[model samples]
Target: AQSVAQPEDQVNVAEGNPLTVKCTYSVSGNPYLFWYVQYPNRGLQFLLKYITGDNLVKGSYGFEAEFNKSQTSFHLKKPSALVSDSALYFCAVRDNVGSARQLTFGSGTQLTVLP
Candidate 1:
């Protein structure tokens, strides 16, 4: 079984400052991690993924995450924050060795960028 944990229910950041959303995962085999963002009444939008390559992976909208195998963590980071960046973020994980297309997602973290 695979699972993801986003400890924070909400993160508040000021516009122009850097922000980070924490995520951790657990899986039987090598994990395929992904990050997605969702807006009000919208489906999840793929942000980035860590399949097999550089530990530091960059994604849409200046977002990046580091895959730490030892810690079993993939934390999302943005150098600068924006008011429009505020949305619901999720961390998902799946077993790389399995063929299942389903992804186990975190509860979700609401990001609020104060203007």
Candidate 2:
């Protein structure tokens, strides 16, 4: 079975400091990975994704992720945190399974940024 786990329930970060939200995934075949962020009472916004390119992929809002094949992980990172960046984050994966079209989300990580 393919799955994703976000180990942290919440991450508190100070503004202007580095931030990281951890994610680990398991898949039977090649994995199409994505990172989406959701603000309170809003839809999920696409932050970044790793399809079939470089391990180091960059996307919206100065965010980036690295795909680790051996570790089976793709962790989201930012050089500096902002108060506006505080939101709920989710890591999702889709594989070659028949029932895997929709994203299976993690429990979610609530990110809090202090000014």
Candidate 3:
């Protein structure tokens, strides 16, 4: 059984400062990592993915994540946080564990930006 763990339910940060939302996962086969962002009642927007190859993967909206094979972790990071960036962030894993291919969400991490 493969799943994602988001230790924090919420993360608060000041605008213009750097921010990070942690995520860790467990998968059987080769892991396919993904990051998505959601704005109040809106659909999730694909941020990035790491299927294979690189360790450090850059993504949309100045976001990026590092794929660590040893630790089995993928933490999303942004150099600078914007007030507009305040939203629900989710880390996902796409792997063939048993059933059909599906994205297992991290229960969401709410990022609150204080101006």
Output the number of the TM-score-best candidate: 1
Candidate 2, position 101, lDDT: 84
Give candidate 3's error at residue 15 in angstroms. 0.9
Query: Model 2 over residues 1-115: C-alpha lDDT tens digits?
Result: 6789999999999999999999999888888889999999999999998999699989999999989999989999999999999999999988766665877677789999999
* Candidate that scores best on lDDT: 1
Write down the worst ten-residue block by lDDT for model 1. Answer: 93-102
Q: Give the alpha carbon lDDT tens digit for every residue of 26-107 in model 1.
A: 9999999999999999999999999998999999999999999999999999999999999999999999767788999999
Clashing pairs in 3: none
Task: Give, for candidate 3, the lowest lDDT window spanning 10 residues.
Answer: 94-103
Q: Choose 2 or 3, whichever is better by lDDT.
A: 3
**Candidate 2 local Cα displacement, residue 90, angstroms:** 0.4
How do the predictions measure up, each by TM-score? 0.96, 0.94, 0.94
The regions of model 2 sitting more than 4 angstroms off are 97-99
Tens-digit per-residue lDDT, 12-103, candidate 3: 99999999899999988878999999999899999999999989999999999999999999999999999999999999998855675778
**lDDT-based ranking:** 1, 3, 2
